[model samples]
Target: MVTLRLIAMAALSFLAASGAHATEVKCKGNEAMLTRYLGMFDEVFNGRKLDRIAEYTSEDFQPHDSAPGTPKGHEAIRLLVTNMAKSFPKRKLTNDLIICGGDMVVAYQTVEGINDGPLFGGIPATGKSFNFNWIDICRFKYGKVVERWGAGDALGMMTQMGFKLTPPSAEAK
Candidate 1:
């Protein structure tokens, strides 16, 4: 009886040690909110499946940094995606890091692509490649993104594509 008890205890200890290595512990909030937030980028943006935007965003999605008069709701994202595809046919958005607190999540992203077409209302294609960083802060409600604030290194990207900067003359000032 003493030998059998010793064997059982050793076996249980071995199983417990192995399970620790295989298990990843995440808080309940992380399991749900983080997954949904990451999915917005993974499935909608990086995946280039614009149709999935609705699944990750609310019907009244708001882009705080968009240009004046940009459309509301998912159509705005669709338009942006369409234009970007036209300019950078192989563009990709990658998330370098993401942080979540309460209902807001911030993502650090990198946008990379080769410019094989025109951009900025028909500026000629330079056939140059650009790699720049962008950041996004999203507000979620009921597991779907309702609003976002983001900015990208537009000037850096343009310079990488061979655009020159000229200072304004005194007369213009």
Candidate 2:
């Protein structure tokens, strides 16, 4: 019995020293709030209501993504959307699924569009179309999206656009 108690104490002390602890994120709010928030997200992103972006996003919004500039702030987000509209005028940010918890929302998105103008890194339009999947996570505060992170199927889209990942020959190089 003494040995068992000593082992348990030692283990607890080691755990405390190592600082290996798990954090549980609990939503202080309700799921309906998240649903409505996601609805607003989709509406602003897809409905071409750039002017209403202020309503859905906080003034100091921070947006992180694979986009070239890693857009941050409200105006940056607006610019990012405007640039996408230029590339694929008919592009749609279709939300396939949304999960909410702990002041955050994760959205599974299917963005379908055609490359009618420059798409990425000043690359000219290939006039091709693609459907890419994205997983976006947003942190909300006061019912506004304050921070966001998103990852999209960029490689797949580039492949569909006929972008070869092959290395050029010595002569081409």
Candidate 3:
């Protein structure tokens, strides 16, 4: 009876191990999905192709920034991009670093542009140019980007555009 019990336990252990291995294999991240997401960033920023957002983002896509509200869905993202482009007509984004792990990608980039257009973030453009860095963390599920979190130096950009929080001290006459 003891020998029979040992054999049955070993068989069960083998089955469990095989099941775990199968699940791990199935849950692996798809490289093609990662590549597509990276490419989408290029198209959106460099090519200014806002329409391509729908192709890479999920129907329920959500983007979170340091700002209070979140932008949801492809249409919202498109509108956000359009407004940003209008605010900085000569804006350029350069990817400084891109790292992908599992199903998440983190991108570090720098944006350079002239603030020569209408005001953004309550700060009017002063026709001044500035460069700012930002970091974005994006997650993909089932080959589509489902979520993103972005943060950058909004105050610094405003400062560069000559918007000072405190009134400048009058120069000594």
Candidate 4:
């Protein structure tokens, strides 16, 4: 028992010296932060209210996983939502789970839609329907999202939309 206690003490001391700490995952539901997070989907995505982008995002917003060449700040989100809306006019975004910890909120969501309009401003509509799952980690400051990280099944959605992927030729390799 004495040896076990000494070992535990030593481990604790080592962790303290290494600055190791537990992450707090306290969910803060019904708060303004969570409210705004959900509201972004409702008002911006579902409602197609691009003007309200500033209402939900900070001026210096940064979406770490935005498409290559997408400008930072609220414009990135605007461009994203606009393209998605054009590609999937009747899309519905639903949050399956939302977790809030401190100033960060994580959302697991799904988007269901039919490709009834032009995609990426040019690709013809496939008239195909698809459902894709995605996740987002948003950091809020002053009731606005200042930073975001997200990933989704773009390849899966494309496959569902009848898009084919071709392998490179041996000569190219």
Candidate 5:
């Protein structure tokens, strides 16, 4: 637990220091793209329209915080949405804040759901409920997202799912 807390704290500090300073250019129409992005999330996560995800992402999409071996290219993102639905079938994302600057859009959101299926590279279902917040920064070009960075509350999810972050010395390296 101590380790997880430390990592989350470091990430929070980094985000606070390096956020919202990426550009000085004005984005006049990016708000509409952001709206479409949120709607894409709703459709993929709730409406089960997994086939339409390609409409919102670029051909050379990049994932900044994706799990290892999570594939690459546009299909990787589609796979992620698919896995999210499989793991948290009742997932809900509530957007708290959204800011668009130039071609970038940053959003703060909370995700609440039950983990009743596969997750984290074959971790078995725990059937436990959890609510955690995350931040997603997406960079767009010509209406499609070119890159995205997601910072998720993994510690909260693990604890809620009845897992422990034991000391390294007390366990294996």
Candidate 6:
């Protein structure tokens, strides 16, 4: 009787452990997808591979940025990417950190490049390389990136490019 009870308890413990492990595996898989998705930005941006964006993003993916009148959707994203490539012929996006869980991920990145060509923002090429940090939060559904909310230092970037905005005289004092 003692031996039988011990066997039953051991079996129950094994089942519990397996269940926990399975949950962990699922979580890790989601995290991997998030990381891979974030890494693809570097690949697509630097390599000028617009198609890769479709491979990772959903057909109805939405991207929100700090800029007003910014583009959205897959085609818009493609245009944005192409324009970025045109602006910064030597652009490079480096992912600094990625945190993900379940179906959400946040990526912190630093983009460094020289705007030596015309871009959508109409900022002429200063031929000067600048580094700016950005944070993007992406939501995933059905194994595809569905939406993203991004915010970055656009003003800082403009300032770095030698675009000066005179402060209001009242505030200047």
Clashes of each: 0, 0, 0, 0, 1, 0
Tell me how candidate 3 scores on lDDT: 0.71
**Cα RMSDs of all predictions?**
15.9, 16.2, 19.9, 15.3, 8.3, 17.5
Off-target runs (Cα >4 Å) in candidate 4 are 1-26, 170-173
lDDT of 2 by residue, 1-173 (tens): 75675466456445533646342323345666576565666667777678888888888998876456665678866886787778888765655566777888887876766678886578888987666788878888988889888799889988867777766674487
Off by over 4 Å in 6: 1-29, 66-72, 167-173
What is the C-alpha lDDT profile of model 1 across 1-173, one tens digit per residue? 75675466456445443544232223356657778877877777767688898998899999888999998799988887778878888776766677777788887776766789888788888887667789888889999989989899999988877788877784477
Ten-residue segment with the worst summed lDDT in candidate 6? Answer: 18-27
Instruction: Name the top lDDT candidate.
Output: 4
Clashing pairs in 4: none
The C-alpha local distance difference test score for the whole of candidate 1 amounts to 0.77
lDDT of 4 by residue, 11-52 (tens): 644553354534333365637788898788788867989899
Tens digit per residue, CA lDDT, model 6, 23-112: 112235566676567555655655778878877778888777636665666776687677777777876565567777777887776666
**What lDDT would each prediction earn against the true structure?**
0.77, 0.72, 0.71, 0.79, 0.74, 0.68
TM-score of each: 0.78, 0.74, 0.72, 0.78, 0.76, 0.70
lDDT of each residue in 1-173, candidate 5, tens digit only: 85686567556444534543232322356758767667766775457686777877877888888877866667877787877878888776766677788778887776766788888679999987676888888888888888999898989888978898789897886
Model 6, C-alpha of 153: deviation from truth (Å):
1.1
Model 5 steric clash pairs: 1-165
18-135 in candidate 3: lDDT tens per residue?
5442211122355575577668877875666987888778999987873556457886678767888878887767666666788887777767677777875565668876667788
Error of 4 at 102 (Å): 2.2
